[model samples]
Target: MNTVMHRKPKPYRSERTTAHTSDRNASAFPSKRHARRYWILLSLFLFGGLLCSLGLLLYNNPVPVQSPSFWPVVERRITAVTTMAIAALCQSLATVAFHSVTNNRIITPSLLGFDALYSTIQTSMIFFFGAGALIGFSGTKAFLTQVGLMLVMSLLLYGWLLSGKYADLQLLLLVGIILGTGLNSLASFMRRMLDPSEFDILQARLFGSVTNADPAYFPIVIPVVLIVSVLLFLSANRLNVIALGKDVATSFGINHRRSVLYILILISLLMSMSTALIGPLTFFGFLVATLSYQVASTYDHKYVLPMAFSIGFLVLTSAYFFMYHIFNAPSVVSVIIELFGGLIFLTVLLRKRSL
Candidate 1:
């Protein structure tokens, strides 16, 4: 009777609900606008990067060849652009996926011992098989073998850690850091024992340089990248949910473990491709991922991934251009990139933001 006499319940619009509705409305169409803006920015960045690279190519005198026609020059430019583009794409994708899985911006796949493992494997190959043995193998075969070994090692390390009772995200990260340190020590020991000439060859392999990219690897890298890109695009929405943390993602009916595993695999493949193509980039991934996050200002993977790729392409291309053309130091591009990337890394840390 009391309920019957009670005034019709007011529409159940709590303040929180009202606020949520407002937020939803505000963000709804704005994402589309942001998407458009991002595409425009991406196009502009690509143009700038290309222009810089082209300018560098033109300014540099080509090596004298049987054919001095522009076609050869065009081919060289194409090759350079293609290699850099692939490297950037792989690094950016790996970085973004790595951040999503670890739920941390400051960390990159490289930090998790991928690069270290790569170095160890390369050094071991040189030590046991000798430089001559490695030379006997084609570049593509060596690259593929390196990638395969890295993947196996990564899986073993990550799988072992994940199989433990305390294998939470933080634990995985801690283990990664420890493993990376150990691997670095081993690599240092190997380097110290190597002859100066061997060390020179190894030193070039350790740094993230694009100058000596093997063209044969391009065929393998391009297809792998395309396939992974498709997989990533399909899983973008899942990544967004995963970023909300494990419980929320589970609540959303996402298979959190499976999602994480898939993402990790994709990340490892990307890391492998990038490392095999150029060399280990300790900071490039972190730099691009952080910059992309800042520029996008959104946690949605759909926006974040593409933006990261664009930014990476722009950075690498521009760096290559400047180092070659202006500085006349193609060999120093990696150093320059790391210098700026390090500064940005510090800035990000000071701001206390995650990529």
Candidate 2:
């Protein structure tokens, strides 16, 4: 009997396998290194640009550096910086946390009606008490009033909706949208009734203006923003888990309802402070948070949060620099931001084919 030597069969590589291998080999190294490099470069660019914008804000004034008039200019500059910092922190942290809890990058905390609420409050004040009362209510007292009202309303709405056993995120979001719509309608009615003079006065406060921030309110805003932001930062890892969906988060030992309630409360307070401080910023937070995700290219809140803050600061400073110095139209900053942000929102929605 002639025994044939057995030959080992070589593994066959199909076209699909070859293509996949080539794709993986081509993409693997560059993808990772590119992400890392993008993070580093973005951080440097934002930080450096912030510094330059700040320098321009401080020294570009007509006041002589050696004159006694310089101190007042410097004081204004300091206040501007502080306002921008608080706005950046509040908008960045709140929006990022809001997006994580909701698990939707396209939506922002603005859905909660902070901006609409702000407009309603201002309009009501002017409608009933007149523009003089609105002006008189300015400064620290007005800031505190707005923050307190916003915080209480948020607590009432969020607590009642989220503390129950059947806490549903969709339901809560629906209620918020209804409330926002109602508030906006009321504000619109009030605006239509106002005389042109009263409307003019109300319009100034309607826009988001860093210059409108009072330094005295800084004492109140600074601590609240810092403390709440730190709390959110500490929960960053949990936020990552929450973004995975409720069932997955629960399996990981996270109490989905409780965590979401706590995060919502924090977001409310943050949005309140920012809105009370800068008036209504319809799209500032959305813009910053969206850009942060794109620039940082990571879902890890540890990286995303700081990047959001940096990007927020960079955007605010750059806009202020150009608007104040170049166009002398600082009040238009909000308009410009909202215009761009609305465009971005439409683009994102069209691309995703979902809300």
| C-alpha lDDT of residue 216 in model 2 | 90
> Would you list the C-alpha lDDT of every candidate in the order shown?
0.79, 0.83
Look at candidate 2 and give me any clashing residue pairs: none
The runs of at least 3 residues in candidate 2 whose Cα sits more than 4 Å from the true structure, single-residue gaps closed, are 1-35, 340-355
Q: How accurate is candidate 1 locally (lDDT)?
A: 0.79
**What is the Cα-based lDDT of residue 7 in candidate 1?**
53
RMSD of each: 5.5, 5.3
For residue 271, give model 2's deviation from the true position in Å. Answer: 0.2
- Compared with the true structure, what per-residue lDDT tens digits does model 2 show for residues 1-355? 2334334333676566777785565321247776677678667857765775667557477888788888787776878877888998899899999988988877778788888899999999999999889999888878888889888888888888887787778878888889999999999999999999999999998888887788898778898889999999999889989989899999999999889989999999999999998887767888888877766656678778988898788778777777777788876787777776668757865776643
- Residue 64's lDDT within candidate 2 is 81
Once superposed on the true structure, which residue ranges of model 1 sit more than 4 Å away at CA? 1-37, 61-68, 163-167, 345-355
Please give each candidate's TM-score: 0.85, 0.86
